[model samples]
Target chain A: MDLFEYQGKEQLRKFEVPVPEGRVATTADEAAEAARGLGGRVVVKAQVQVGGRGKAGGIKLASSPDEAKDVAGQILGMDIKGHTVKRVLVERAGDIVSEYYVAFLLDRSERNYLGMMSAKGGVDIEEVAETDPDAIARVHIDPLLGISDFHARKLVFGAGIEPRARKGAIAMIPKLYNAFVGLDASLVEVNPLILTGDDRVVALDAKVTLDESAEYRHPTFAELKSAHEVPEQERLAKEKGLNFIKLDGDVGIIGNGAGLVMSTLDVVKAAGGEPANFLDVGGGAGAELLSNALEVITSDKGVKAVLVNIFGGITRCDLVAEGIIDAFDRLNMQVPVVVRLDGTNAEQGRKMLQEAPNERLIPAETMLGAAEKAVELAHGGGA
Target chain B: MSILIGTDTKLVVQGLTGREGSFHGKRNRDYGTDLVAGVTPGKSGEDVDGVPIFDTVAEAVAETGANTSMVFVPPRFGADAILESADAGIEVIIAITENIPAMDMARTVNYIRTRGNGTSLIGPNCPGVISPGKANVGIIPGEICEPGPVGLVSRSGTLTYQIVHELTQRGIGQSTCVGIGGDPIPGSNFIDILEKFEADPDTDMVALVGEIGGDAEERAAEFVKEKMTKPVVAYIAGVTAPPGKRMGHAGAIISGSKGTAEAKMEALGAAGIRVGRNPTEVAEIVQELRG
Candidate 1:
């Protein structure tokens, strides 16, 4: 959901904010061309989802197009916090007199959308929170009333915008709020919102996370969606209409419901095995859903072994076991599937699975035991 | 006494013409819940599970005198459904849909607060509540629960079943076990139900099963520390989950210091709530507190 700096800036420009001209580059040659387009004095920033790119050598300042190419060559294909560098944002560098931070997020307890602003910027918000929480001005927007001009003025002054820049900052607040709400964004952030030496304000960096749940309303947002942003297996699962989230480690997981999937993930990890994914088959996950889920997990090249953990209360465990058996038969599974069934007719469910063919159907007494068995099997030990 | 639904409570099912709504509506009726009416736009003349279907919540409530509504509306229109039900003066609204946008929830929750009127909301993503031996109003399989003095509350549905199974294995019984749903915004909170548990003399002890997420557990811990006399035992799942990846609960992501399992456990422990490391140990903690 983390947009590239150029993408963020494009969205900002749509809101009529001042931004340095920029273009995203994929290769060293492209970076050089982009730098030339920006008048040959530009900033090369690695296009990764994470922050602290500057500290990680992902951001470099170049005085000439050749220097931009050199810096982009060093950054291209390099890993920044586990995200591969696929693109770089080359922009005209700005002469800043001051930098500030501004963002909007949901505050659950207050049940309101809160706008947060700080005079200090270009650093992680966590640092600001830890060192001086009071430096951040928090403004809650009542949903009924929405964000008003008064609220914007309050936030502008509270964020310590100087007298000269105060009017401009206040004017931008409502536009930013409109963008945040109009885009169905979970987050709309402007980091290092710089005040140019000429008394003009420009957004130097931007990060926006769109709310996926509202994608149904905005058809155009679908073009911006990239499956590569999430786990590979989960992307396929989403394509198949299954809810899946990939985690680190060896144990492949398929459970019913989000809560159960999470608890199963915890139990598997607690038993010293990492969960490969969070796959919830939802309520009444029939044989089709189960088969689709298993196929999705087995398709993953990273998954070593599979764990079929079902605490079937409303959805019958026996049905889930049958689905696993059907999926195993359909796919001719190579990896071991450790089954743990506990709930209504659980013994019957286990008995049903026990009736399936012997080689891939491994049974364990407890969830912990099942996870241990799966991890061990995946690690190359005999089942 | 249950925190929300009981056998004595008159029930109405919104979106009752839908497959899930009709299925659960009939099932709840068969389970002894007084399913008095149903609400589905343009299906007003129909009868679902022998209950009259009305066009609106107001019509249903007025005709059937049903104050409790179990909403099965689809996620896109769920907020409007709940707000409509609330506007109609339904005392409690339990929404069983999943994946409601956080922004939509914030607006709905904020609307309720501003209007100074809100029917209790159980979940946009939850298993609902079961007042054992009384009535069940949710997606949770009812056969797993039994009526007794232990009031059980959890964020995980299957984990709730597992915890109840463990408790039942140890000869403990539950009075009313509520699944508050694992979404970031739930209709009711841990503190909302804990107050009812504190007031119920039949409930001798309370078991709270929380997961890594928002500060709900911390707030609950503070409530139990200040208000409750009965013993409170708790457990937080996904302790080993990686920080950035959501461990399935939409609200379970560890953001800063608030949503980590360690933070939740520390807050609960600091508030004097006996914290269990796993669901298997939840029953043991409750039993020890019973002593």
Candidate 2:
């Protein structure tokens, strides 16, 4: 789950990391009011979960409340790439001595948490990595020991941070680490960890991606979930606790496991058909779940055919078949349906599904056969 | 004759009194595995499917002489359960729990590695391993597999079954099929299983199943080229899968140019392994190799 910049900053403040005072404003008047509270001068930043916002003219320097309102008016409606700015973050403008980069992330290469620091900030780290790899200092910290003073000192000295600000940098590194650990974040970055003219270290920008698997612990993060960012079908799927993602085709796919569902999507595409959505009914798909799944798929106007693929292990195929039959009985679904049953009690499930004399129901003996049938049905076969 | 588990493997099912635990415990036993005991913290006096339960893994191992641990616990205690099993001297443990926090996995994986005990873990979200007709350890159905010379390894559960089923139907039997889990960081990689397959005398050919996410397959391809002598047919899933979205598996996403199907296929093909476009096609490739 990616966090908007303001939310990331708010999280940083919660961990006692020094940050510029900021307020999120949704309108021009709100921006002006926020600037007034911050003593007039401010930086109006578009609060979208995309990069290069500064290059997109989504960020502006406002010297007065009137300029803040004008800049907010310009930014709130601007689209940075595909994400439209519905809100602008108004921050108190700062005086900087230097800008430095710092981030703590779950590194795939190390298969561990990595603490990266660089004296060069406010620029893409990838550029620094490519042009001069030595500019960035990366240290993989054992999750057990955590971020230590020694680790911070090593990072600061290694990144070539000036000796004068090393003490403040040392003090700030562990705070960011605490936020990363406390929030169960996969990534927490403070690019442009600014040194004000008074030698105070403050995070000027933040980007965070929290682990959704850790949602059981952090209920507060629920407020950060953007409903509008999700498509209607996807939002509905989330509401129903279904793993569903909308795609652009006519065939609706339902499968038991993620890998199987993914393979099903590929197979359908290979057979010259596009999938309407990706749906993993998962382990415990019963009658109600199946009914709900069918309703969700049929609700999509682009879906012309629904394919139910089951490879039961812990999941019984007969129950799935019963669910499919129950779904047909409950929902007024008009699309053609293709069913493929395998694994536990698959024969019984296939028999149950075959006994259904519904003209729209088609059963394939193999997974590949099922894909071909679903594709064939989606192309021209009608109810 | 195979890797991971065989006739001598004694099993302890953690969280055995719980729903998934007790059920897969029965299924594991019914499939002719030597499931000696179960551990459910406080359910020590209880019996699940005639397997005696213990309060802790140590007691379970001490009494039942269990050497392998299979976990079916909730996401919260999954890492603890794996660690407990490892600390109790189980060398081979498989975790079937999904949605475990990545940080939990990172901490636990580091612990498992630094412990200096050569304990091998298969998954935190995998189907486990099956040594066809010999012993079934985790949840891979014993029915679909056959005792042949071909070995199989996958990062998926159902897709592993799909490929194994294809092999069985086409008379291309397997020596062992292992699911290494599809998490961002699984306990085992394709190289671990490949090295085992290459060493096993009974295994003559290998079928490798991989998906988007991580450089495990590419690294495994490198290993295959360097060490393995047997014919290895490969299948990479999520070809049509879009970037940035996880295609079912936590580890099955293309981050930037890495973990892409095109890249994995290219690496595997360059290593001289025939890369199949789909499961059935992979089976055909294996059939031709065996023939």
Clashes of each: 2, 0
Candidate 1 positional error at A86, Å: 1.6
Residue A2 C-alpha lDDT in model 2: 82
What is the per-residue lDDT of model 1 for residues A1-383, given as tens digits with 9 covering 90 to 100? 55667776777688786778888899999999988988957999998887778899999999999999999999998898888998998988878898888888766666678898888888888789889998888899986678999888878878787787776678777888887887777778899878888777778888887777788897856777652376666777977778787766777999876666777788777767778888888767777778888999988767888998888766778788888888888997788899898876788889988888758789788766787788788787897
**lDDT over C-alpha atoms for residue B273 of model 2:** 92
The regions of model 1 sitting more than 4 angstroms off are: A227-231, A300-304, A344-347, A375-383
lDDT of 2 by residue, B1-291 (tens): 788888888999998899878888888788888999999888888998688999999999999899999999999999999999999999899898988998998888888888878899888889988888888877787888888988999998888998899999998788888998888767878887898888999999999999988888898899899998988999988888887787777788786556888899999999999998888899988888776
Between which residue pairs do clashes occur in model 1? B121-B187, B148-B174
What DockQ number belongs to candidate 2? 0.64
Each prediction's DockQ against the real complex: 0.63, 0.64
